[model samples]
Target: MTAVADLFNLKGQTALITGGSSGLGLQIAEALGTQGARVVISARKADVLESAQAHLAGLDVDASWIAADNAREDHVERLANDAMERLGKIDILVNNAGATWGAATADHPLSAWDKVMNLNVRAIFLLTQQIGRLSMIPNRYGRVINVASIAGLKGNGPTSQPTIAYNTSKGAVVNFTRALAGEWGKYGITVNALAPGFFPSKMTRGMIEKVGIEKLAERAPLQRIGDDDDLKGAALLFASDAGKHITGQILAVDGGVTAV
Candidate 1:
């Protein structure tokens, strides 16, 4: 019984969450912290990270924040080194940092493509690689959840926002989850991606309003957009040891949008 309880509980584990200083990433950090995991939250803005650190502190979970540019190679190393120095071992990692922009393929800049891919796709791979090489793989136990989008699932409005690169990057994220999961499963590390539908964050509100939220609800079998609470259970399932037998899966929290 105690062992089972321990499996569900995050006590004694340390988690590193990228883009964790705000939005959904911050929400996840708060959830895990209250559940008893020591968390390390990172993002580009030191001020926002500090604010998020205050929020996590109120949850009574041990936590710290690091300002890191996920798009930079140097930042990745510095971020990893700082995390290890502070948290010592990261039992879990959440790759929630991402970049997105809305422009058609024809109009998209090569620089834009490179930027989105670097932050969303390449950075995820680099961070996971660094963390795995330094800590998780050697310990032979780890959990990683990458945040993707349903935009990766299907195209949004016809002209709301083309974001060709954003779409492609997220698609890469979905597949990356599967490929990494397969390779790392034998080592007791699980890699997965969470594809969120229409949630109002710094991203997606423009598209949602332009597409007409009610129309979207009607199209989505679930009849609604995503809410904050809708995120917790699915995430907890993957992060907890309850997910021990699971890997290489993409759990869509998209309000049934992907179904139809």
Candidate 2:
């Protein structure tokens, strides 16, 4: 039997994480890197990437950063190629970059919808396809982690801010993770998704403020929102050998909000 420690060990592995300069992406990066994976994080800002890189360095992690706007196809392509060149191979890919737009369905603009879908759904598909073809398929080994949301599981109540486009895009991601997992399992690649509830970040800052953190926390059975270290273990499981038998699954890291 494999030792417990070895199951989660990621020594010598390489991971590429999108939107990894902060929030949940950076948390996941820290988990994988501290566990022994060489991590490369990407975001749209070079300055932010530099700060995240330095933060990881403080933890004694082998971490690098690349600045790329993942919503752009050309940038996504270049990111894949550049990461391949730098890491030689990508053992794990975390599709965490996404955007959201808040507007009632009746008032939503077509352009805003396009922007949300492009970043949240289209970019994930493109990056995963490129990474699979460039590395995972040929190597016959990979772990793909898609960062979805609890919003995808169900609709928001009447009182909440209308985020129809964001919800719709995340719903697409939910199915995308399952569909890709089924198709790619034959190639020895396992695909899974993490459906997180409210976590305080740049993306959710406005929402949190609008709803009030205490009120939001009351909805969950746990009576609290997620914290920095909350996502680390779950992410590490999916990214490491610990979760080799797990695929085509969506695990909600949402304070048990979806449960009740």
Candidate 3:
């Protein structure tokens, strides 16, 4: 195959995206599926996952849905087991399930912090470890993509949105990607992260409805918010052969938000 053709092709591969029922995860699934990878989407809600399956069906992609709570300990391994059982072997895994609760830095509840941290940081770590040991590490090939945010890069003031725990968890994810990448590089497992800015999705619905998506888009240097296609090439590079040698890195899909 030509360099560029094979560089981006995901043909004959299998990808499993967590929290894939909607938003960024769904977008990434579409990109990988369109490129010929059989995709499996997992989420806590069966209804949502079913809907996502239908959404991808029209794309003519080999897609399926599994109901799994990534926050739960057993669900992580189960997801990998189910994927391997049905799809053969996993090549791409996106740790995209996360929880965010907003409160002032001074008054945030510890319970809320625990909830966010468990799913955002702890779950990510545990799931990745299990999958790595059971599949990726064994095969000596895998791609792990964690979804972080601009908050992870820097603080978001209260006037804008105060979710101290959210930022802290994502920061952990950023560092986790780097550390895990270093540990797994020799094993042919590349760990990377996508730090996205404002985008319209269930996660950002509140902000968009109140502030207007245009206003948030304009905050960045590009004078725009992130969109579906923004993550395509960035994610594809990391998952495809194009990024075989790239690891321990975080790619920002924030329309220059982090640069400012």
Candidate 4:
């Protein structure tokens, strides 16, 4: 049997993370890098990527960054090619770049819906297709971790923000994980998703302020929101050999909010 430590060891592997300049994307980047993987992170802001690279360097992680806007097809294509060139072969891909727009279903603008879908769903499809075709399929070994949300698993209650477009896009991502896993498993590529609940990040700052962190905590059985390190173990599991047999699964990192 492979030793447990060996299962989780990523010493020689490499990863590409989207929206990795900050928030949960950076969090996952830290997890993968600390575990000995060389990582290439992408986001739209060059300055932010520079800061993230410095932070990773401080942690002794071999890291690089490519700035690209996933919402644009041309940028996404360039990001894929650039990341592959830097890493040589991407053994893992983390689809963490996304967006959210808050508005009542009736009041939501069509442009906002497109924005959310373009970043949250279409970008994922495009980048994953590029990486899989470029590196994973040829090598026949890969791990894909998509960042979904607990919101995708269920509908919003009366007290929650309307966020019709955001909810719809994340729901698409949940199934997208399953469908892609099935299609790629034959090629020895594993696809899975991490459905995180309320965490303090730039994207959720407005919601947290409106809903109040205490109120949000009350909704979960754990009585607390996610912290900086909460997603590390789960993400590392899915990215490493430890989760090789695990595919087409959605692991919710919510603080037991979905349970109740």
* TM, every model: 0.94, 0.99, 0.97, 0.99
Kindly give the stretch of ten consecutive residues in candidate 4 with the minimal lDDT sum: 159-168
Please list the residue runs of candidate 4 whose C-alpha ends up more than 4 Å from where it truly belongs after superposition. Answer: none
Residues 152-258, candidate 2: write the lDDT tens digits. Answer: 99999888888999999999999999999999999999999999999999999997878889999998999999999999999999998889999999999999999
Q: Candidate 3: TM-score?
A: 0.97
> Considering TM-score, which of the candidate structures 3 and 4 is the better prediction for this target?
4
Cα displacement (Å) at residue 227, model 3: 1.6
Indicate whether candidate 1 or candidate 3 has the larger TM-score: 3
Displacement of the residue 13 alpha carbon in candidate 2, Å? 0.5
Model 3, range 158-226, lDDT digits (tens) per residue? 468789999999999999999999999999999999998887789889888889977887788989998
**lDDT for each residue of candidate 1 in 38-113, tens digit (9 for 90 to 100):** 9999999999988889877887878899999999999999999999999999988999999898777788899988
lDDT values of the candidates? 0.87, 0.96, 0.89, 0.94
Instruction: Give, for candidate 2, the lowest lDDT window spanning 10 residues.
Output: 207-216
Candidate 4 lDDT over 47-142, as tens digits, reads 999999999999999999999999999998999999988889999999999999989998899999999999999999999999999999999999
What is the TM-score of candidate 1?
0.94
Better candidate by TM-score, 2 or 3: 2
lDDT of model 2 at residue 186? 96
- Measured on C-alpha atoms, candidate 3 has an lDDT of 0.89
On lDDT, the leading prediction is 2
**Model 1 residue pairs with clashes:** none
